[model samples]
Target chain A: MLRINTRSVQILGQQISHRRLSELSLLIFMMPALVLVIAFVIVPAAWAILISFTNQSLIGPNARNFSFIGLENYVRLFNDPGFWNSLGTSFIFVFGSAFLGQFVIGFSLALLLKYAGVLSRGIVGGSVLLAWVIPEIVAVYIWASVLNFQSGSANQILLAFGLEKQRWLIDMPLLSIIIVNIWRGTAFTMLLFSAALEAIPDTLYDAASVDGASRWERFRYITLPLIRYTILLDFILITMGTFSVFGMVFAMTGGGPLGRSEIIGVYIYRNAFEYREIGYGSAASVVMLIINLTLALVYLRFTRVEWSAEA
Target chain B: MHRSGNSLLLRLSEYGFYLPILVFFFGPISWLVLASINSDPGSAWQIPEQVTLNNYLQLVTESDLLLWMGNSTTLAVGTMTVTVILATLAAYPLSRVPFPGKGVFMYALLLARVMPITAVIIPIFSLSVQLNLVNTFTGAILILSAMQLPISLWIMKSFVDSIPIELEESAWLDGCNRLTGLIRIVFPLMSPGVAVTGLFAFLAAWGDFLIPLIILRSPTTFPIAMGLYRAFGDQGSVDFGFLTALSVLYSVPSILLYLFARQYLVKGMTAGSVKM
Candidate 1:
């Protein structure tokens, strides 16, 4: 009995060592990705935070000799009306396109497609996806041409209706970008909601109907409750994405006609590359990061509360 | 009879709802195609007196469009390959191994996705300069892969998690090691996920405008997006015909990719949204 007990203990020790070796091997597997992320994302982001406190520049006198300015850039950022204006513009852009436009229209489209025939589904799905699949630059160009002052198709259509041609990009640049963004982004929301809606069992709706519930009531009680998580997820993603939307707006209006469409992203790029104020740009970026992080935290908290309540 | 009529009305309203969407989505693209072929450059919206392929011919002959496309393809393929391999390697351990600080790694991935690219571009730029990697395809690929890695890792990890570990364990029982099991047993099942991840990585790297814009200085290394932007800048408001033609050509690959992989693309893209 004593010999058996000693033998079993030796076997347990071997098992422990084997597990440790495997764990170490697993760490090896994780090393490449960890190195890449740390090298590229983590390190650069940390450096950006450091650079924000200093007077860095891409060109001019500060290019060679830059020193730490210690919150001066942040102070300048707060006092700058352009920064405030860009933030306001970002808010409006996010609210208008992502929240109001994409959510409403995409949800409506998803609900519509739910009942539509196969042919309509194919056509509508294909058409909406075309907008999404095309490159951002190409989409911007398409919109640019369509909204051009002289020979734009939009004005042509208006002319056919005996209406006046409006200078879209010049007169109402912000509104124009909002509309363009809505057009570009609604497809994603639609696809997301469509998938969510599909996951809802039809049996619930049938039971609700049998219980004398109206279509709206059924949707409110059953569909809404079931897909609330999906809606939240969509809102979080689209908000963050729209907040950083640069390429399309830049290509279309260059955030122009007096910075009317200068969203935060465009503001950062303009400061960083065009004006060559790398430090100020980094400051703005840091602020933007804070805003995004706050938004993410808020949503995460909301989801957590929701999940805990359910549990 | 009333229910049937109600259903008909619903269908008609659905069609009505679809009309505007169809127009909104397709109108710009259709107009672009029409304008590309229109003989008169001055009036892009006008009915063409004669449709011509001259614009396309001019684009190819006058510009370095082909070269730019080649560069774009190389950047995209390189980014996709690197991102996939790294993501897969990392995802396996993440899914299978029990380690302290695992949650930290996951959160780091999430934070990477949440943080805007602008937040890091400055340091990345300066770092690239310091490393003397500026204007190189390697630099662009590295940066793009890094930017795309978090999402790819998240996606690949989800895929790996969905796969049963029991299958791998069964392989282990068959006298196979973990690496061997992953390669032979797990990889085959994860192909769908990998394919989707690859497609996304390819699309993202292919369509990226900002990273390439900053990193690549030489015109020779310009991707299609940069090439188009340069062409637009050079030509300005004139040459609508050539510009539209270039736009159409620029859109062809992505459009073709969408047409081919719409099902997988939709499924894969939405999978993360719903799951998360």
Candidate 2:
């Protein structure tokens, strides 16, 4: 009885000590992530917010020389033609590329895959997967070549068909960028929709089929409602994802042919990196954060979604 | 004949759906392949003279393309290592422990994920400059690792959630400490998740452009994305053959990496979809 009692006490003591150790180690382990957030994310974000109210330039020697200007930067931004044009351009690019393209294509493809035999599904799925697998920069290179004006493969194919060889980059910059974005990004939608579709029991489809529902009917009634939340989730994620995209636009159009394809990301990049308007750039970034957060919030509100379900 | 017509229409639509996807998807890649092998440089934008390996050959013999590849590999592997370690440690408790503000921490990470890198580029730029880490491999790797950690943590946390707590408890009853139980029992089951998370982190760091573009101005430290951008823009007109060759070469490792890790991705992503 004494031996057993001693063993129980030892186990209790060890458990207490281990719990304390876990707590200490947890703090130590969490430090790197915590410090990184403070240094790169939290502090920088705070700095960005503060600097937005200042009149700083890319040429400034330090952030100290920048004087506080209350809302002038934002006031100027609201009145600036470039900012307005960029905001409009941003809406077009984001909705056209992200919302309309990826969502429709992703949803439709999911429907097709659901009905498609396993073999066709793999083939179709794998082909889309190839585009996703290739790096965004590489995708840009491929599309850039295809969209070439004078001697592009696109022109060659058009010429072979006796069609006029139009200037893809110059004539349709926004459309060109949108198409490339769609090409590169559809895979994400495809993957997400596939999982979302699987969450739907096959029995629903069988029930719809037995009711003599046509493919379109079933899709309209059954598939669409079921994946509505997934679609909304996909929308928010893709919208935010596309908002921040740079490499594709930078490569395919350089936000140009007279800045026709200039989304907010490329616009901010030019202001910050190219023109050296550090403070102005930070202001633009601050605006971007606001827009994104608002979108995410709006998304959560409409869909009644919470991100903490642990998948 | 009526049934035959219906079947034919169905088949045609099936083919039709695939046709656009195929043409849009494969058309560019096929052109890339042809351009990568074309003999004349400008011929890539035009009709190809003939298929040749000269472009690929030129990449190796002429430039620091190989060095860029090496740097990408190092950064990717390094980011994967640090991210897996850090994310796993943090995620374990976030998954298991009933800590206060776990939701806040999780939300903060998500917010970090969505906040564009461009937004924070200036402050990060200033900080990196102050640290004298501009154009350093270590700096790039550190930033990339940190950038990728939030997403990795979310994914791995879900993976950990799938394992029953009883498994850990049983191990503890066998006289194992929490760390030991995590290392010995839990980690083995979580290997698939780790592999996928590592692959995602590796690809993200490997293919990233903007960070490298701003941070590493030197040609010596360029990743493939930046290198391709430079090759395209440095000249008045794009260098089609060389760019295509470089793209093809760059894609090889990632494609291989994908094939090796494809199984893990579905699992990882399903686990990750919780946050979505």
Candidate 3:
């Protein structure tokens, strides 16, 4: 499949058949990355998956010491009411933060920027990214103060307006995390949609306008369809990102008030580190992996990257 | 694309559109600054009747704040450098070379990036322990680099792909290997992307909290995040003033970084999203 170079015709164009040598050099270049990935990411991951089927403890030295308990861990997981609750909480967090929250705000912001003139777009986009660039833990701290029940800035603002203080974190844990996540993450969605929106040819919109389409009609027919691929991409990426969230929740609430915000990450962290149930924790991770892969596969099936090839 | 002449209604709607944005986004950051400056923690959390520099002074005087800052900067810079280099080399073949099993390799890297880091934390932690890398700056960097490689690689591959293949073809015909072509030609064009992705990787490594908390058990190796969280949360008595001050300081470096690299970061993030 290599294209013949016309200019090289005059010269003695050599066929470089040193494929093995090239492959070896490539492997040499790739060795460090491959080794680290395999040792840290792959080996441990595979070990954890295998451990999920066994009764391994944190104190155990060898992988062999643990008895292969078959699918008991999985069966126990099914019987555990707390696991289901955690799963439900994880779903709520993902949907609340990623899908319904960031998606709507980010998509709208992109639309607003698209309609606005260049100066406005630059200012809004730049300002939004300011928040996005801040460290997530720092963001969590800032929001934690804002969500403080008594003396926090949120209640202070509410009190300034002569309204009752809302306990953002305590009264509503899931909603609080959702809002904070949206605040931290919407910039990403906005950036994606903005790029997609800008790529839409202006003539298409002009054509729609000439056809007497209302602003909403043009947006519905032209804007949404054009950026649908980007939107799907955003949805999938955000889903994965938010599903794995731990830092923000840890910094803000630490899965508090009776583990109300205990998503799987916190749950597994507690299981492994706190309770020393390393085997159970590995089992939980395996479950999480299954969930994430299933979701990713479903997204790929639905979006079908080929559909966006023309775009 | 039609531009309606400026009308009173249109101008009114502009204000309408901007109002909510200002309220939601600007309000919290403004409050954070205000709270950080106020002398009294309780009243600072409330409407600050007065402001002072004590919160900042208290933060600087109370702890190893400078050391934490240095740690974060070092870690971010290190992680960025490693991530960019490895990702670039990995991305080149995936984007350009029509090698067999390329699709599978690309998918593997993608899955690694998009998969939950929390899911891998225990495994990574256990591995780090085995390697005797736990609590070291290098260990944290390694984890961050691995965690960040997937997205950085994906972004980099797309950027490389968009470069015209003919340019590389000519270099290849001229007896230059792939590395030479990449170094002298492709790298210059791809530098913008490299800068952006590096910044992102740095930010991710810098911003991370859980990895440091889980792996770095020693207090001396604590990043600013771990330092502040432990200082604020673990202490029997809470010091809101110190927490606010630390948070403000943490926010400043990252904001300064963004301001310096905003152009590259913006372009990088948007262009990188094309495939995601």
User: In TM-score terms, which candidate is top?
Assistant: 1
The Cα RMSD in angstroms, rounded to one decimal, for candidate 1 relative to the true structure is 4.3
lDDT of 1 by residue, A46-75 (tens): 887888999999988897689999999999
Q: Lowest lDDT 10-mer window, candidate 3 chain B?
A: B267-276
**Winning model by lDDT:** 1
Global lDDT scores for all candidate models = 0.81, 0.78, 0.75
TM-score of each: 0.92, 0.91, 0.89
Q: Among all windows of ten consecutive residues in candidate 3 chain A, which has the lowest summed lDDT?
A: A302-311
Per-residue lDDT over B1-276 for candidate 3, one digit per residue giving the tens place of the 0 to 100 score: 235554567768876877767667766776667777776664234456677888888767778998888888878898999888887777666565555565556556656655787887777877887788988989988888877777677678778778997797678678777678777878887886687778788878788888888887898888898888877677456776787778888877678777766655545543333442
Per-residue lDDT over B147-263 for candidate 2, one digit per residue giving the tens place of the 0 to 100 score: 888778777887888899878766876888888998898889888768878888898888888788878889888888888888877657666667889999998877888888775
User: Where does candidate 3 clash, by residue pair?
Assistant: none
User: Chain B vs. true chain B: TM-score for each candidate?
Assistant: 0.89, 0.90, 0.84
What ranges in model 2 sit over 4 Å off?
Answer: A1-27, A60-64, A117-119, A299-311, B41-49, B263-276
Q: Per-residue lDDT of B1-276 in model 1, one digit per residue for the tens? A: 999999889878777888988888878878778888887765345667899989889888987888988999999999989988888888777777767666655655766877788667878888888888899999999888888888788778778888987687557656577678888998888887678778788888888888887899799899999988876766455677888898888788878866666666545544334452
Docking category of candidate 1: acceptable
lDDT of 3 by residue, A1-311 (tens): 98965767543244345533563466455556666566667776787798788777767553437788898988988898778888998899999989887888888888788778778776676667766887787787777767778677678878889999997877788888888888888888887787778788999989988999988899899887777777777788788879988888877887776788888898888888887777788899998988888776755554322222121
